[model samples]
Target: MAQVEMNRSVQTRPWFRQITPAQWQALLASSLGWMLDAMDVMLYSMVLVYLMSDLHMDKSMGGFLATLTLLSSALGGLIFGILADKFGRTRSLMISIIVYSVFTALCGFSQTVTQLAILRTFLGLGMGGEWVAGAALITESWPAEHRGKAMGIVQGSWAIGYALAAVVSGLLIPLFGWRGVFFFGIVPALVTFLIRKGTKEPEIWEARKNTRSDTEKEGSVIKIFDRKVVRWTILGSALSICAQFGYWGLFTWIPSYLATSVSQGGAGLSIVKQTGWIVIMQVGAWLGYVAFGLLADKIGRKATFILFFGLAAILVPFYGFTHDATRLLLLGPLVAFFGSGYFSGFGAVLAELFPTSIRATGQGFCYNFGRALAATAPFIVGTLAKSMGLGAAFSITAISFGIAAILVILFLPETKGRELT
Candidate 1:
């Protein structure tokens, strides 16, 4: 007990100084998986303009494919979350990486939109599963006080992956074309072996297994919907729905919007330039994720969500309405920063909200179930863009952000500094 107290005292220091070497390894492992996962999943979005021309797809069809991936990812997250709970997180993480890697590489072989969508669906399975496993693994291992910031590190890695995709797309799309761009996704799969060798199942998970009754030890996806858990499940899912919708709707279209011709109502940047712009925005996104973690830890989760969500609501229209490249260059980062930053809170909050047995399942279902519904946003935005223009379609996504902010305040309680066990 004295040793435990001493450990807790040490952990109360500055965030980075507090984590043990083992904790750092876990963070690195989770961050790497997430970073590469983002690269694999986001490859489709980054290369979307090229896919449109190569596959002869239009705005609606393109957005439909993005929606399809999200829908599939919901299934993936659910399955893997259950797996993480019942089997083990490290095992599930490796499996998910392999699943996404194989499917993402196969995407290069797709001959049509139908074929590509099918490959993306399989890829989404692994992509979504990795998050369930990785987030659960990190949250369970770290102290509750710094869990948000740790999640921020994991979530922030997505920006690194996003930027890497953009950079690679800018170079590869113009050189070997779209097929070559997807092939890079196969590289991340190599890290699965490292994960297998380096990481272990969380102590919290193992401790629960050793100490609990049969009823407590047994894992079930349905357990989250129990009388006491149902309200939390509902509120988390609802908030996630708004965030996912706003996110998928905007980012899915932004690259295409930048690359499209001014005559067709786009910003009219070249592919190379468009990729550069997206990369710059991802820097802000990375900071946003990191900042959200630190801020959530300091000010509490609910207030952090309000600040970021409010900024997102305000910036969506400002970004959408701007025509000049100069203005876009200035406003894009702020828009991406606020819009993408709140994600750091998602894994932290969901992990805090449930028991060790149900944590992964609860996080996966809340986040990905919302993902399934939010999947429609891209298609809706795409269909609307045909008539309203991409600017108008994007501007309208602010409504979802507004709703998300309200839900955070009204429904979800702050989980800051709450002990995980």
Candidate 2:
């Protein structure tokens, strides 16, 4: 009875109290990086239709540009992961911020799809690295027990970043057009500089590197593929691939889908309403992210993944096929919640899968590698949309989520309370 009461009380206690000051600061730093990265990357998605008209491009071409960004990000994350493992996570994080920010601003000046594509590919480099650096930093700082929650909070920032883009686009697009949205991407660079001056490297990482010889500290991409780490890497990559493909396939077109006229296979809503709906749906997403962390910390990682993946599988199709604005408004949040929330678990689960020696490298490869493969999703969805309609195009995401659920159940182990070695 005493133990039961103790467990109940602990459950009732707020999760934030368990985190340390330094951990909190690390969370703040990483969350800001992710949030800003989301703002920069999604800015393009928010304005893609306007861009299509201005650049005289089709959905497939726009999706291809998005694909280029994802593809380049794979290399960027892999490279930066090596650098983070070798040099430091904080430094890599800052440099990534600068790279993405500068190029995102440059995207505002693009005259053609070719120009935008080039600038976006360059921006993808920094954009991918931001997650690698930030996730590594936060994962290394927080305790094992709190890792899931910490990652959830950090991943929750993606919604914040998405919301920031929506808010800024809603306000700015009317005044300065899509170009102004891209110009705002440059603002995060200043944030990177401040975080550079303010934060230090995780001591665990420092100790691990300090004990090793200069030669020993060198990072190798091939090491993640060795016998010991390869299995987990494959599993993690599969999950990441499904999540990325499903997410981008559905969301890259949501704004346009919401705003497009009924004749062209959309809701025919105005830009303001579409932006408002997107923002509102993200509230559900934010709740999902928060809930995943808490529940993963409580129930266990495997169950959490299975639960959300299943929910996403069901909702993605419902969302895609539903046409009534009223019904969509109702289903949208639940769809966003389940579809986006499972992401909170990825960084924490992957961080625990490998030791410090190859942590960054493994994570970079797995997360971005899946992203690289998933790069084709947007293009595939776009091409399909030509004949099947946008709603039908998104049903493919349900299949991706279904695969992720199966992989999680069949192969992935529970890392709920496992300490990071």
Candidate 3:
């Protein structure tokens, strides 16, 4: 009897590890895909100045292109979310990677502003799809006990991608020009092969496929809004939109805000100094992502979001006010810590709120749709800066964070420790 009990315990040991090798492989693959997705998307922002000058496009055109990308991403998420649910996660992820990579490379070849805008729109679709499939796959496969960590790690990939884009743009833009930097974006397409070779369908999704009949499966993706789930969908979408508005509105302009001449109502930091500031701030963002996961797991998701976003609302305005480089350097991390930390909770919360049949669809709709709405951030902030000054323009982002805190408190349900289908 002792031997029998020992054997049972041994048999269960594999299930009890924080993250099994298979789970880690899934996380790595998903994270890499997401990282590349971010790299491809962010490449545009990093090189926007060069593109605008080379192509002779004005700020409105640049803002319009950014808006187009966001709108396309919403459509991509909706389409791919349904595909991920109906097909397999691995397949959807592979397709998304391929689509984005091909289009991103194509952007390097564009001769006109119209061509670049069109290419970016399509690229946005693939970019949007990768996250929905990857997030859903990771969330479903990871055990509930460690789900926060898994999503945290996955969410953290965005910072890595952003950092990579900055490094590549800084190095290659000097050597190969902005077009050459875009050409390099093609390298991420190689990641698709890794997915095809390394990943299998998650056990949960595979089991669902085997157990559920076609007729019994959930109906159209629109059914996500049926009587039982629409409220959560609306709440999740509002929170996500608010977050995106806050992030894109402020961070996208930091370099411009810093580097523009003082006569133009800017801080007048040099290019090298601006890059250093941007990179350093991301370090704080990285910590925020990891810390938010651990804190949410301990104190609950709602409390953690409120803490970070509330602090962000307070810190963002202060970050805008300081002109001293030393003070700016010191405050950058704190602003990022509060401003960027709450993002990790979205994966865990969305996963918990939706069931398997529509999980990806729900996640995609809430996130990508919100992104589409908030895509106006760049344009709005730019217009505001043009008229009211950059400092005042950025202060609006703080209000968005404040709004996110309120939404989470009033509407979002706690999702910690909830098992996924």
Candidate 4:
């Protein structure tokens, strides 16, 4: 009877109490992988203006290249998702890091638009793969109770990477030119070594590997869309599309929106001011990521996402109408808080929902497919900006948040405290 009581007590404890040191280490490694991944991708956005001028490309062509990157990212996500499930999350992550870093540096050597476009496409492929593997790695390693916080920390790495890119651009773009900026991009490949040395396959995945039959061991990508999982696949894809469209559409153009001359309806801030604002805004984004994780953990993923999205829908439009620098300084954080915060939920929620057999594949498909849909954001916003104004172009972004909020409230189920198989 005493032994039975002890067993019951163990089973009744919250999931957070179950985490081990090894799981924490896995989370850190995956977070760093994701952080560096963002650094590589954000570098392109930061230096895109200069790259366009240097390559003699127009806005339309620039938009086209961004679109190409997104499309290729979709392909990469699908391919790597399969590989990650078939191979191992750690191996897939290392390969992706190497691929993106090499091609990102190669971008520095490009003399023509064609060359840059090719490099960006390859970079997108690697970029798409990294998140899928990293998210799966962290999800499978950590306990369900703390998974939201872990994923939040992992997602928060994006802001660090984005902040780093801004700093690098502000420091290097003036001295070494954009080419030098691309040169620095290659440094992220060093992260692969840490991953290769320190990380191991999660025990869950190891057990799954050992238990699998010959057919199951094959781990085909087609399994992700099996009847049981297809609804989740579609839901994740839709949510990702909404989030990415709003983010890339509004934030990608914001620096230009702020720095352009008044004739273009911009604030005409100097590069120094632009960089300062950009970096500062990301600080809010970082906080939002952390906060969203905690909130999702406490309340529920669905509830927290709805709250953030609702706030975003209200705040984003207001962000456009205001012109006071001091007001913007105060409001920028809030904008980032709502615009970027909910992303943290994806890693935790998606990881919990999918089975280990197709976890990475599901993550990649949902995320990269959303990116592909979002690839149109720049183009759509650019066309709107050309006709109406930057302020009005941003209004469209608010609609995306509304859509996401509704979908989360209506469609996505709460995943907090759920065990990942």
The C-alpha lDDT values of all candidates are 0.89, 0.90, 0.84, 0.84
Give candidate 1's whole-model lDDT. 0.89
Q: What is the RMSD of candidate 4?
A: 2.4
Better of 1 and 2 by TM-score: 1
Candidate 3 differs from the real structure by a C-alpha RMSD in angstroms, to one decimal, of 2.5
Which ranges in model 1 have alpha carbons more than 4 Å from their true place?
A: 1-12, 213-217
Quick one: best TM-score, which candidate? 1
Q: For model 2, which pairs clash?
A: none
Measured on C-alpha atoms, candidate 4 has an lDDT of 0.84
Each candidate's TM vs. the true structure?
0.97, 0.96, 0.94, 0.94
Candidate 3 vs candidate 4: the lDDT winner is: 4
What is candidate 4's CA lDDT for residue 304? 93
Q: After superposition on all CA atoms, what RMSD does each candidate show versus the true structure?
A: 1.6, 3.0, 2.5, 2.4
Clashing pairs in 1: none
Q: Ranking by TM-score, best first?
A: 1, 2, 4, 3
- Candidate 1 residues 1-421, lDDT tens each? 9999997898677768877777887888889999999898888888888888889998899999999999999999999999999888889999999999889989999998889999999999998899989999999988888888999889999999988988888889878888999998899989888888878778988887787786664458789999978888998999899998999899888988898788777899988788888989999999999999999999999999999998899999988987678888889889989999999999999988888889999999999999999999999999999997898899768999999999887888878989976
Query: What lDDT tens digits, residue by residue, belong to model 3 across residues 14-77?
Result: 5336467788888989999988887888888778778878999765677678778888988898
Candidate 3, lDDT over the whole model: 0.84
Runs in model 2 with CA error above 4 Å? 1-14
